[model samples]
Target: MSTAAEVSQNNNVGPVMRQGELAQAVVEAAEIDNPDKIIKVEDKVAYLRIQTSDEMILKRQTIEEMLGRPFSMSEIEIELASFAGRIDTQVEYIRFYHAKHL
Candidate 1:
């Protein structure tokens, strides 16, 4: 487990979650994606910080698969303690990334 300070100091970007079933689901979804970007995970006693180089996405269907139950994207807001990138949510997925200007 990393201290809050250490997690914040990280230059990576992703979602932070409070400990619970939802947190577990997020981890599982990330593993399934296995993005090319470097991903870092830090577990704090009551919170978890999942970081990636630039972008990450977690789909509602994937979470449902991990949880063995139906899930709504809105549920993420309940466990989302914080985040370090731009967030885009749709009916099927949530994406975290730093936006690039045109």
Candidate 2:
């Protein structure tokens, strides 16, 4: 088991989203949008924790593509239960990141 201190030592950042289609789409989007980063997803039954080291980005376009429908960036709030690190949201993309490396 990992301790909180051990977990916090890494620069992991992303969202904890309600487990459903939207969360699945976001995970797929994060993977596609951040090809350089290793996206991680933790299945918590009730919610899904999607994250990456340092930074994780999800593009609206990628989500739309994953969902096979139009998606609004603001719509993410409906499924966002919590998040790690600082978040930067825009019309085109949402970024979860640490301000600096430890």
The Cα error of candidate 2 at residue 40, in Å, is: 1.0
Candidate 2 per-residue lDDT over residues 1-102, each given as its tens digit: 998878767788999999999999998888888899888899999999998988888888899999999899989999999999999999999998899998
In candidate 1, position 24 carries an lDDT of 89
After superposition, the stretches of candidate 2 with alpha carbons farther than 4 Å from their true spots are 1-4
Q: Which stretches of candidate 1 lie over 4 Å from their true place?
A: 1-11, 100-102
**Highest-TM-score candidate:** 2
TM-score (all chains, Cα) for each model: 0.82, 0.93
Q: Kindly list the per-residue Cα lDDT of model 1 for residues 3-97, writing each as its tens digit.
A: 88676554466789999999988988987875566667899979999888667888999999999998999889999999978889898999888
Instruction: Please give the TM-score that candidate 1 achieves against the real structure.
Output: 0.82
Worst 10 residues of 1 by lDDT: 5-14
**Looking at candidate 2, what is the lDDT of residue 10?**
79
